[model samples]
Target: MESEAAIFAGAVFSLFGGGLLVWTATCVHNHRPVAHGVRPVPSATLAGVVAVLALAIGTWCFGRL
Candidate 1:
């Protein structure tokens, strides 16, 4: 039961993280500035990539359990 919950949570996180990664990439490609230049493209891209990676790891761990 706990494992199932963890898997479900992981799935949700992974889905959102993946979407964020795609959105960030699209923003960077289209040269769209964010937050009035408060958040630079490269920084946002890197953060998104990291978030996706973290979520992937979490998903894998949940699956393994």
Candidate 2:
């Protein structure tokens, strides 16, 4: 597997990003919904930022292949 490190990093980044995005979605949903009960850790905006960064890094890693 050429660029194995890249592949691994890409996979990790993509998964991390995907997870963050899911968490953010949940956070947003919970925040709004019918009414606000409690806020989750890491605001949606912050999680979104990290998620985008991770996804971008993953894309870059995959591009190396």
Candidate 3:
């Protein structure tokens, strides 16, 4: 149904937004000052963790539909 599709789309967008928020926060928290300027680089481990968490959340959301 259209409602179900809308809910699913909302869930996906929310999950993506949450992931981006976390990633941005991590980057800000781990920002490093370089010779040129401050560079915000999220660590690989942090990125991986975020990715896994996002995947889990997405799976759970879709499973509920």
Candidate 4:
């Protein structure tokens, strides 16, 4: 049972970390273009990516807990 818990905890941490990193990188990507005199990212793309990542992390954490 403890091992199971550890595995679950590790999975949750991985999911959360992965999601956060992806989201942060995407946000940076979306912003960087404008800073360099290019068009800003499409709002829909950013929102969708963020939403998917958040959902994935939430589901993973819930399963672990």
Identify the leading candidate in terms of TM-score: 2
Candidate 3: regions farther than 4 A off:
32-65
Candidate 4 residue pairs that clash: none
- Over 1-65, each residue of candidate 1 has an lDDT whose tens digit, in order, gives 88887887787778777777777777778877633556676677676777678678767857876
On the 0 to 100 scale, the lDDT of residue 10 in model 1 is 80
- Write out the backbone clash pairs for model 3: none
Between candidates 1 and 4, name the one with more favorable lDDT: 1
| Model 4 weakest lDDT span, ten residues long | 31-40
Best by lDDT: 2
Ordered by TM-score, highest first, the candidates read 2, 1, 3, 4
Writing each residue's lDDT as its tens digit, candidate 2 over 1-65 gives 77999999999999999988887787677664322343444455666888999999999999999
Q: What TM-score goes with each of the models?
A: 0.66, 0.77, 0.48, 0.48
Looking at candidate 1, the ten consecutive residues that score lowest on lDDT are 33-42
Predicted candidate 4 versus true structure: per-residue lDDT over 1-65, tens digit per residue: 76577567657656665665566567666655312443455543554466566557656655654
lDDT of model 4 at position 64: 58
TM-score of 3: 0.48
lDDT of 3: 0.59
By TM-score, how accurate is candidate 2?
0.77
RMSD of each: 2.4, 4.5, 7.5, 6.2
